[model samples]
Target chain A: MSVAIVFDREVAERWHLREVGVWMFLGTVVMLFAAFTSAYVVRKSGADWVPVHLPPLLWLNSVVLLASSLTLELGRRPGATARAASTAIAATCGLALLFFAGQVQAWSTLARTGVYLPTNPASSFFYILTGVHGAHLIVAFGFLAYLFVRTVRRTDVAGWPYLAGLVSTVWHFLTAVWIYLLLMLRLA
Target chain B: MSHSDSFIRKYIFSTDHKIIGIQYILTGLAMALVGGTLAGLIRLQLGWPGLQWPLLGKLMPVGMPSGVMTPEFYMALVTMHGTIMVFFFMSFVLVSGFGNYVVPLQIGARDMAFPLLNMLSYWIGLLGAIVILLSFFVQGGAAAAGWTAYPPLSAVASAMPGSALGQTLWLLAMALFIASFTMSGLNIVATVLSLRAPGMSMMRMPLTVWSYFISAIMGLLAFPPLTAAAIMLLFDRHFDTSFFLPSGLIVAGKLLPNHGGSPLLWQHLFWFLGHPEVYVLILPALGIALDMLPVFSRKPVFGYRLSVYCLMIVAVLSMIVWGHHMFVSGMSPFSGEYFSISTMLITVPMTIIGVNMLGSLWGARITLATPMLFALGIIALFGVGGFGGLFLGNATADMQLHDTYFVVGHFHLMIGGVTLLGTFAGIYYWFPKMFGRQMSEALGKAHFWLTFLPFFTVFFMQHFVGLQGAPRRYYAFTTYEYLNRTHGQNVVISLVAFLLMAGQLVFALNFIWSLVAGRASERNPWHATTLEWETSSPPPHGNFVEIPTVHRWAYEYSVAGEALDYTPQTVPARQVAVTA
Candidate 1:
């Protein structure tokens, strides 16, 4: 009798799980940063705050992240060719790598200037904000790379557009979070 | 997985929601044993301070040297017990266990929206459980900073023996738990949105699904701040960042190297998650009771819409009232008043829920089933717990009661007793669908009476002693003159707590014995209305021959002029009319 049950996979196809999941994930990530931002505000109000200087390279990295978002979103627009999408996806991944490189340069510059994680509360917040943001972006990058491979190889493109759409959603969110962290760290 | 799949594929790696659900329930029960033992140790120290226990001495020579439990070891037991019971058992079983098992089948969906994520959530949660368990044998013993793990004591390794590696392991386990919840919570929310069967509107969905969905979102949004705080705490401990440690602190007659940290910041972040976390632990259980009550009473649930609204209202209000937990801290008076008012406001929705439960059971053909008894226990106990909470939620009353046994009693009655009873009801009500067998009614009723009486007695005595200003987390109750007066009460509570623990064995035995030999349950054994009972007992993979089109609301029982006492949500209205 159990064998009589026949599940239709078609009904499940309409399930926009990827989109729903990404949105929920974005909510969690936002809360994490919100906590960090609140912590920064409270800590900055304390004595011995000793504000750290913003890295010059961080400005360039911010542009790189913003540009990557534009490229990914443009590639995922309503009517892009598969080849164009593949190229855009790979380019976005490359640009993300460049952003990471710039962040590393910023960190090294801070280290050269005799500032470490424990140097001052300001420096500690600076490193934590950037480091945690970078950690999240790295996961986004891996997924983007997977999409890039799929688009390039044409191996599994059944739901390429939907997959690309989810990728872009997360990509843009991280970019926005990066901006929020930058502003919070600078303003506070 | 196919029927012919390998054993590992069928059981271990199976993405089947039912199997995953059973896995979570069993794992939670296993962790409960560990937690219950920890509770036993705590009671032993409280009841018979300096009492010799050579058996425990052999197990932990450092903690129980010469058969006498130290202040530090007693603390570790307290920390792990709270940690295990709250996170591993209640949260695990209610949210993940029943969420996975019941949501899909009841909603008429085949499985979770993201089955792989659901699987990962369970395995990751298990890894977290194992990590916390391993913390016990760590160099300095298990974490002793209480389950909350407030800082300075938690930040400085030299502060205490348990603060060293055990605290780090505790942080790691907590981080893993957050990640797992993020994964599972996301899956539950997405599944509810993306996978509900046709005709099952939001209002048509079972109360259990709504409560689970609301609770999952609460966990998802609330847990991250705690994650953020854990990261900062880790930095303070190892990297000398001093995120939560104050600058002028002196530990063990030594000036600490840390400077410029606010321990209050940790409390804000912790309770941000911690407060909503209370709702996350109980809402699903509450939903379970509300959903099953109608089936046993043979009456449509009273004010179904109001019940759902109360669930959401309670959830949203729970998020904002977190500041009440901080009233005893150095918070401003204005903020204290605000939190106090917000916390008390929650009682309105909760009162409405209690009223609805009683209203649903009013003048009904109340069956004396095991699950029904547990559901009744939820209403009665949760009602008392809710009223008990008013004192703690108010700033004027809570300031004095803070950290007292009153606080302990309040939570035990609510999160501890009510949630556990609710979870047991879920297990008993759904046992037929889960395992194709009916648990023994005799044993179940016995378990309920034994557990309910002792559980009520123990916590009630705690409240009495607590009102006498007996502080909690104290090593020796006999040390204080005021507390010494409550010595008799402490012994009674301790012995009753042991009885509560022993009663759980009946449930365990009933569960195992039923799995092997209980009578097979037929489809819709209770003549229920929910979609889950419409499927085969021990539902097959994908749950349905074809996903059912839900035709009506979940609670349809004993309609006037109806031939059958209940009409399942799947039955068309025209068919019901013809039958009538």
Candidate 2:
């Protein structure tokens, strides 16, 4: 007796389920940062806190991050021509690299000012926030690089749009996270 | 695709979920032995202070020199014991092991959503366990700052003997464990949500799947805070960042350089994950009992929708009730009252679950299967444990019983006894499907009675000891005049604990013997009405050769005018009507 099992793959609803998994993961990442930020705020209110000056280069890094997010979202448009999408994807990866380099510069500037991690709680939070955000950005960069390679080589192009869409969503989310972290550091 | 394939592909590097599940089960059982031995050492020092352990003293001259355990050594054992039991034994064996083996089959899916990711999860969890086990032989013993590892003590290396490298290893091990859990939890959630059979709606799924799904969601959301906390703790220990270390702290009469950190930050982060984790442990156990009770009693489960809603209610309430753990930690009176109310409110839904199980069993032909006995045991024991929580949940009462043996008894009855019994039931219920062999029912029943008797004897005696104000985590209570009067109870509890350890061997023997030489089993050995029993015993690589189309709810037992007493979820309406 043969029984036909109608899996969700045919229902065109499988992609939505995968997207739910990805968003659930991103939700966890949000909580991790939420915990860190809450701790940062509480620790800052302590009597011995010494606030550090914000890095001048951090503002430039934010612009780079925001621009990359825009380019990635444009690349995700279903109606975009292949050449247009490729260019946008390439530019997004480049801007992400520049943003990473800008963060390194900010760290060096802080070290030069003698505001190292042990200087005070403020400097500690600055390094920790930027370092963790940079780490996630690197993972996003690697993902975008994979999409970049696939688009350029035209290998496995059938899966290109979906893969690019996932990378774009993550890249955009990280961009927002960076802005939030920068604003938090400045306001505090 | 025969059994004679290469060993690596068949067993080691295979992406088969069944093999991965068995791998988790065996590894967890082995770690339980290690965790159990650590408990033995802890009980030894607690019962007979400074008594020389004749065999162990010669083996480890430092920890138990001349057979007499030191205070620090006793502490180290205590820390590792809790860590191993909670993370390795319970997390791996009870949740991941059984969940991996059962979820896909019960959902009528061919395999996990991501088979390779499922394989990686187990290996990573095993690596985390090994890293923690290695901490035992490290220079400072094994993280004696307690399993919670709170700071200023945990922040400074010189604060304790095992605070240096041992605590660092503990943090790393825990970080890896969180990673593994997050990955596995995602897969379970994804599989359950998307991979149900053709007609299996969310409500149509078995209570086991719902429990596993809810528990997985809890793990996915809760583990990240602990990961973040572990990273911060690592920073405080090594980089002198002082995330958990406050200003003007002095350890060992030396003024510390660290400043501007709040220790309460660690507690908030820890308990956020820790309390939800209690639900993560118990929900699966509750799921197992709820799933098994109807089958044994030959009746439809009472108030199925109510049972599911109660689980959802408990899950949400458990997240907010974490502050109850901090009632005596100088928290505000208002916050304490809030937490107290939330904690007490949880018992309402918990009571509903217990009543539903009893209601289903009422006026029914109850079978005395070994798994049924364990399922019923969980309800009785967990009910008592739930009542005990009210005392601790009350802010006023908790002030006196904060770190007493009463709190210890409460958790052991709930997380310790109930969860372990639930796992035993799952093992017995699924052993046939897992290995195509039947466990000795006589041996299984005997194992339950032996384990049940000794378990209560050890943990129940702890409540009276706590009433006498014998505080927890102290290696020797000789310093307190009131505690000396409780020494006789301590001896009895410890002796009974050893008997509990011995009782586990009956289970071990049955489990091992069944795998090798026991009688073979057939499909639906228990005449159950679930998707898992619809397939052949020890389901093949793709689960079902022709995937079933589930037509009704999981428990459709004793439908009027039917030929059989039970109707499987896969049976179509036409067939069932014709039979009726």
Candidate 3:
């Protein structure tokens, strides 16, 4: 029998099964965050809802986040060669760390503006919404950092796709949620 | 060495699915004792107002001083009892216990897709149970807000006495508990989809697996909304967020600083998860009933495809009908109409399922074994519960009956009645398979009859009290003329509840006694043809030593030309032909 058939029938069974489960879990998390963002918008439009000012640092954080996504993508490229791929992975982790620092700075800036979490309902929501999202991002970043370490150590590229796909998808989703929250803060 | 040999490592603390199943059963049994005792106290307090029962009075010194139940303590008992039984006992016992042990074995898999995660799921769930129980001793006592934990009442510390640290712990425990369930759901779905042996097609797979698979999918989709709701409520309490608290709200004549949040928002998120949660609790029992009815009837389940289709329909419809719970919440009029129509539409598929179950029992060799009796009881109780839905499905009727004991009766019959009865059926049916010993038929039948009579007596009367304007979740009612009329009925119901609580001891005694003392059984004592029956009793760690290649569907009993009534799945196609 051909190698493809042999592998497909034998080794692929357990691997494919695991992939389906992991993807389903990742998809569920994505949907959960998506629904929360939608609820945030709907609730933001209610009467007496006060809007908080968006921090400028968020724009810088967004850029760092988008760049991290791109770097992670580049690291996954087939023809990029090993050294370049490892460098891209390390850079992605660095930018992710910067993104986290930027978020903390943004919170500090908002606090200085007298927008403490317990000051007003608007401020309280701003902290909770972003804080929860940031906490999730921190978790995702930890997973990505682990992947980066493994990539630098020359772990098999085959396993990378699952984690890589999940991390990128979640990163993109977080970015989209931030944009939605930003618009709601500024306009709605 | 014989495959039946076992070491301590192979039994207790074992990663083996069978052992894990026994662990859940034993733990659930222990929790049931606490739950049952609480139920007895609740009934005693309700049966004779101000009656000083010694032990119960001593347990709740502040709430039931000399056995006079304070409303707070009564609420606490009801709240904890409901929470413990539904989450810890029913969900764990019916789904995690039975589903974990049987799903893989019946589908011909060695173990779950992720055995390590599977074990962790059980441990995390156990940890969650401990956390929840610990809330009883917390500063403010256990969470006394109704299990739904409606906002403002549940959000503000001044709202209720128990809305303080205890409620916070309850929220944390629930969040952790959902995480554990999510892990288990992922495992069940993955194992069912990917691990069936070579010839066991999805169609050939047993109904229990299908129900569990669908229930897992429901849990995956439904639980996160509740988690989100719980987190928002926590923020409202601890961090002064107004997510569920409206502006200009006055609590206890103190102008609450919280503003601009809609309480309806919390309801929307909660019911979104709550309605599907009913199915998550009931579907496994329904699956158990489906599996047992066929075996006892000695026939393939009537309309197997239709039954599966009904389960899918119910799962999807469950998501939409959540809005019905919001009917009285003063949501938008349009939303009420949408929820009302969707809620009624669920009955279409539910009817189909009921008909298929009744049809499965028609014109068959009905063996009135203990499991079969409970299975029949599930059909009857589920029918009563389902029929009662008509009163609540209509917006007009719901306006009258919402939050009434009628709704309580409806749910009790559906969930507590059908689900618990079906769980008993499963426990008795699978006892032999799991322990390699047969439970006492005499004790089983006596327990079933005692449980069946009291169950109906308690809940059947509840519907009337509900119709007569008796609100649920009320610890004590002021003596109005109409309310006084229903007091007699309440007394009767409480008496029956006491009996129902006592009847469970028979099950407990039977279970423990049978584990060590009952007669050992042959591998396939039930003479069933399911894949699980083909394996050795208390199956090996990897389940079947040689994977079974199915020649036919699980139910092939009494087929033409077969010498034996049943045909095990592992039997070769040629042997089937030869027997024919």
The numbered model that scores best in DockQ is 1
lDDT of 1 by residue, B465-532 (tens): 88999999999888678788898888889999999999999999999999999999988787888899
Superposed by TM-score, candidate 3 places the C-alpha of residue B16 at a distance from the truth, in angstroms, of 2.9
Tens digit per residue, CA lDDT, model 2, B397-470: 99999999998998899999899899899999999999999999999999999888899778888877888898
Point out where model 1 deviates above 4 Å: A1-15, B577-580
Q: Write the per-residue lDDT of candidate 1 for residues A98-127, one digit (tens) a residue.
A: 999999999999999999999888999899
**Would you list the rank order by TM-score, best first?**
1, 2, 3
Per-residue C-alpha lDDT of model 3 across residues A63-96, encoded as one tens digit per residue: 8988888898887665666677678888988998
**Model 2: residue B193 alpha-carbon error in angstroms:** 1.2
lDDT of 3 by residue, B215-253 (tens): 989988888878777878888888787888888888878
The total of clashing pairs for model 2 equals 2
In model 1, the clashing pairs are none
Off by over 4 Å in 3: A1-12, A119-122, A155-188, B1-13, B572-574, B577-580
Q: What DockQ would candidate 1 receive versus the native complex?
A: 0.75
TM-score winner, 1 or 3: 1
Worst 10 residues of 2 chain B by lDDT: B571-580
Give the lowest summed-lDDT range of ten residues in model 2 chain A: A1-10
The DockQ scores of all candidates, in the order shown, are: 0.75, 0.63, 0.52
* Chain B TM for prediction 2: 0.98
